[model samples]
Target: MNRTAPRPSSLACDECRKKHLKCDSTTPPCTRCTNESLLCSYTPSRRGYRRRKTPWDSAKTAAAQKTPQHGGTSTSSFVLGDMDLNQSLPLKPGDTTPPAPSGSGIVPSDAAVFSAEAPTDTPQTIATNRSVELTRQEEERLVHLYYTHFHATAPILVPRKRYATQAYPAHLKAVVHFIGSHYTPAFDSNLLHDAVEVLLSPPQESTLHTTQALLLLSIAQHARAYHVNALATLSRATEMAIELQLHSRDAPVRYGGLDPLLQESVKRTWWEVYCIEGYLAAVHRQPSFRCNSVSLEALLPCEENAYRDGLEEPQSITLDQYDARFFADHSVAFSSACYRIEAIRILARVLALTAATVDGPDDIQSVDNAIVAWKLHLPDDKATAIDRCGDVDQMMLQAFAFMHTATVFLHFPRSELLLRVPTATDIECASAMVPASPTSAQHATKAIVASKELSDLAALPVNKYSPVFTCALVFGCIVQLSACSAHAHSCIVQHRDRVALMTGALKSLRRHWPVAGQALRKLNTIASGIFNPAQSKQSGTSSPTTHDSGIGMDATMGDLCWFDLFPPRNGTEDFTMFGTAHDIWPS
Candidate 1:
């Protein structure tokens, strides 16, 4: 009988055997042979498969072959491996053996098993897909958590215990992380407002230390928003800081380590609070609201009470001495605070000017002088002192300059200043009086010319500084400048003679724009209707009016003329110089 010769028992690796290739029976599968579709063989018995001597092994195999209890094809063997034979199988009682492969009726050795019976798809592939899906779901969950936790309501309320125990710390950390890592100019303003409100709200006696710290941080951020009420928020934060300091003295110091960054951040917040309080007090007309001498003194560090030689000596001091020695110790914190305060002050002055509330030429001149003095004291380099006095010094100088320019504009009108173009003789006289220092001379000349022009403009009915009118004028100027550089250049050239004669005026005026934008918005709200000249009847006539002997119509035109020199920028179209113009206009 010509029977088919028994198929040679191939000793291929399980992978190769499954592909139906010939076996080489090597220790490891041969890469070349596998690539060529030949059997990348191994001694199957010596590989992963071992002889099963235990009853557990037999039962595990049987269990693996049975339909899975979870209602799917059996895949447990692939995941669990040949644990039973190894005596490491964590099997329950009554487990069954896996079925032997069909046709051959020969149970494949563990090495021959290659992979567990795949369930329509590979586990690795399924795991990869599951991981991807899980990650996407996690991201969506985080976003939902953020919105629900932070932005769902105007003022979210938590149970006092819950807030103290959990919510405060979590939210504060979230906000800090967000501010530290993901700050952008476009976040919702209400987020900051709500955060401030929550932080400032009185805490219960049971509030956690962590909660208090977070509240302080939130308050600090709120104060830094540069909004109309930011100063108020900062003031409250300072009070809380004092409370924290007192609280810390009694509490055990438990932070894992002293974080210099966190310390610096806290100090900065305190400094800002002090500065805003000081500046607001200095500028506001209301006596009750003004910062007092005691407050100002408090803003400075307490004098060290060290005993000297036989006599207790009162040290001779310069402003620099106070800044360098006393304030210097807290320079980083104090200076950051000072910068914010000065920035706000400068902005406020600028708004006052844009609103045309400045009283007279003298007022404008005084502000100019203050700016010059402050500028003289400014440090020329990056402020690195411990107290960072240099930064505050610079901010003060800049603030002074901004205020000076604003005062001049507020007190004067534009058209009158333009008409008072300086004569050749006037320019010569002004140039001859220039100071020896190049920087001083440049600044002085700019200031003088700007002041003179502003004074001249103040004399014109068209140059009136009513809040509404000023807003329109400033916005119009910004828009005009922004739209056409040629127009700006022409305006500058036309007023060059007057600008040159005033000495240091143009430079000073130009420097104030950034600061002035803030003030302009405030004033616009104060005098909204006045900005629209078309909306209001002419005060008397559009014609420029002559003033006292010292101030001519030309002089007034010179003052007003400063407004016409610069054009607005392309992206600044949305910025109305007098955003608050409607507020102050007669009802």
Candidate 2:
């Protein structure tokens, strides 16, 4: 066999360039490449790549918008005060209407050219608006606060600069103000929500803005003690997302020429829908969402910082790459958002397995494998859930929270982990004599260890992450409380204290999040059934705190309406959660 002769070239071969090896500068094959039978070739030099620069006009715009506020967040320059009064019609879900005015508000509206003070959260409010009853300035502040706190963690919305300068229809702005006002002390989100909802016309078109807005509203609705409404909103968002083809691999290309940020936003929006719907399924105790499976083909999001900086990955990694990396030699540094997506997807599967109609062993085993693989495949930076700056990775922590919760849900039935009272999770108990899948001691240990780890995550300041974590804390507490009840040994007291930690975390979250408030009430009831120190010790007649009684939950009751375990809050406003609706709390 005649080998292709080595020929001189101007640069190193591709493989040599990658390895930083000195190449003989050859065509066909370099000397070393020929000896090793390597494909030796070179092309363009990858030099002079620098951080993308903001154009002078954009820079000037950004500079003017960068004025600092409390919490070190910069105000964005979105001119929303003078939007044109054109026939801005809002679209209700499944309705047939055109839409509210659609444009980046930097230059907007047929009736008004509204511009407000750049977004700031310093207890300052500005005035200007036509349809929605929020001032341009208040909208600015709430939107800015949402970007600073919520977006940094979840990141579904546009960048802070882009959001302030450019955004969508009035109803979309309304959904934003609805959530963002929860972070702002000076405004009433409820009134804002009503005002925003009133703008809805009969639904007609399903644009990206409408899809994005519904996603935000669904979770916000859940936060406001409306799980049914949240479920409905999520259903609509899921449908709209599919209608937008957000679940397809080529979804981004389907949109005409979106800039990098918008392209990234397209992917982010779909993943957000999948993750949020998973949360809703767990909260609602329903079947897994169709979106979770539908979005499997789409590429996972790029790095969190890259998305923030408006740099799209030339070739994003697929879920297949993420799953294959565990056995493959090379690895990929997945973004926090990607890991979050994977975690929630598995969580959905875990929930589905627990709710399975068929008594199949393969399903549970497969889900368990996926859960373990998720942890084993976590890259170095993500393993610890903290960054080099010592800041907690909220999204990564959320991913871990989902994974840990999955373990508890998957094994809570088979592991023999005790439960004090009936939890929001309905368990189908296996007979002690002949279990279908024998309850492994390993499974029980995983439940307790997972419970402890969950408490640690709950230790994060409530503001650092989404209030949706309210469900995870409740799940962890159920296991911790059960352990506390099952064992009176000195060791069990630690589990009892962990129960307090989880409960306290929910209480802290409840101040702003109604779902957490409900969870707190439900947890106290569970505690009462388990080993209520106040009730048990004071009454001097303790309930059995052992394996026999603690583990004997009724299998026929099915899943509880997780949030409705306790009755309504009786129109009571928690004082700790409110000094006044408008009192500014710490960021």
Candidate 3:
């Protein structure tokens, strides 16, 4: 199906802009209003207006490449000013003039932003980028997508009620647009990422909004495989949050008597920082939880329903109170974010257990026990990953996924399934081994159970999960794939189909996020080694025709899609001859 070319619009009609409807910018009533018998006005029409493009010349290239120096007047980085951000603002009724785009934006290595002729603070062309040309309808759909698909997991930003009316700062707006862009087909994800990166680089005033923007952007960066950038960006966000004292219980009152909705946003932001810090650190096998109870006394987030509706939370629980009282009171409903915080706390314990020299069984068992207790105590409503709306609760799914991942990390070493190859350093499982005990068999069974649970979680119908959940899924899948290579050929046959559950989930998720793509590529490498006996036999030879000539392969098989690990084999052929799947990494 071919899409029709969009009609030329000198300017969006006032009514169409307000309604976020695509308009032809035709004389008098536009097609939308004329068809619907609604009034239309176009006060800001500039009939002969043509958008000017900045030249990507040698001078600009040199300027953009200049490294940052302290107190130096010349730097490649410059903040896109408010005027640039205003290009994103919705057009108002009876407005005499529409906001024009800025003349500049910071350039990234892969793309150019503007020429050196554009002065600093000359608000860059925020209206459109070389690769991003979304119309009003697309923007609304993307924003809708953020709340629908991603926001429930983090649940920081409010809906368009606030955004459509408020004059949000550039960084916040940039992050929002970047997040929403993930779900939009009209834009290049890389261009959007570079644009958002530039928007956040310059020194901006330290405000709660800036802190929130940084936090969201960090998640976005990590989701797209920008690991180092994500870490640095998140560190900056953490420092800004700490500088604002958002970790203190009284920070809101101490700073200002922020309104109820804004207050909840603040609390959510602080806890999110803690959750993400613990999660990323543990995932990377680094043991650090700066926002833990030792220093911060932040409150848990309010219910998602109340927060979304702008209602005041009747009560808020602290970390200590939550541990003591949450299980005792059945009526005390906890938010997914709260459970997620607890999950990270457990993951942190797993990190500690993995780091420590485990001399006895208690070391791993204790962390394993804590995870069990957390699962048993979960409220009946959240016991499963289903919400009241009968939809897959993404945050709840992530919480469970995180819990199961901890279980895997706790037991994968002792699983003792028979793989001799060492995993990547960052992958905690089998990368290093813990001291063995007689209870190692129990740990092996536990690891298998956790991986199975992960497969079930991945089997849920959804395009994506939380970025944290995606990591958990990858880690969990690694354990499952390793199990497929068990010594017993019969067991391998049994578990091979289960592996598809995870591979298919990742295959679908990477379509929406590049983080999963990275994992898939790595996993494909590991898979090729495990499944391709012929390749393993000839250690240093040209690659085989696994891409197209495999027994069960079809032309529709996508790149990096190594889900088809086995084909149907007759009785005569050995099970090992099932063979590896097709190309996973870029050639």
The list of candidate 1 runs beyond 4 A from truth reads: 1-200, 203-235, 238-266, 278-370, 382-587
**Across residues 1-587, which tens digit of lDDT does each residue of candidate 3 receive?**
99998744536666675544567867878888899888876543211101122343234435545642111222331223211211221011111111111210110112222332233334442233333444445556766777767787777766446654333454576567678778867656666665565455434446777778888887887787665456556767777777788988876554325466656777888888877877776554453445553465877777776777765533457877678753564466677777877888888877666555433466656777889988888887889888888888767787888788878777776555423212212223322343245665676688789988988888788665776566766666666665654435556554566666677787888877787776776665555554554664466422332321231211122222221121111112222221222122110
Model 3 alpha-carbon drift over 4 Å, by segment: 1-141, 254-258, 326-331, 357-360, 418-435, 528-587
The Cα local distance difference test for each model comes to 0.29, 0.59, 0.58
* TM-scores for all predictions: 0.31, 0.68, 0.67
Span of ten consecutive residues with least summed lDDT in model 3:
89-98
The global Cα lDDT (0 to 1) of model 3 is 0.58
Better of 1 and 3 by TM-score: 3
Model 1 Cα lDDT, one tens digit per residue, 417-456: 2222222123323232222332432333353444443433
Q: Which candidate is the best by lDDT?
A: 2
By lDDT, the better pick of 1 and 3 is 3
Task: Report the Cα lDDT for candidate 2.
Answer: 0.59
Which model, 2 or 3, shows the larger TM-score? 2
Q: Candidate 1: what lDDT?
A: 0.29
Is 1 or 2 the stronger prediction by TM-score? 2
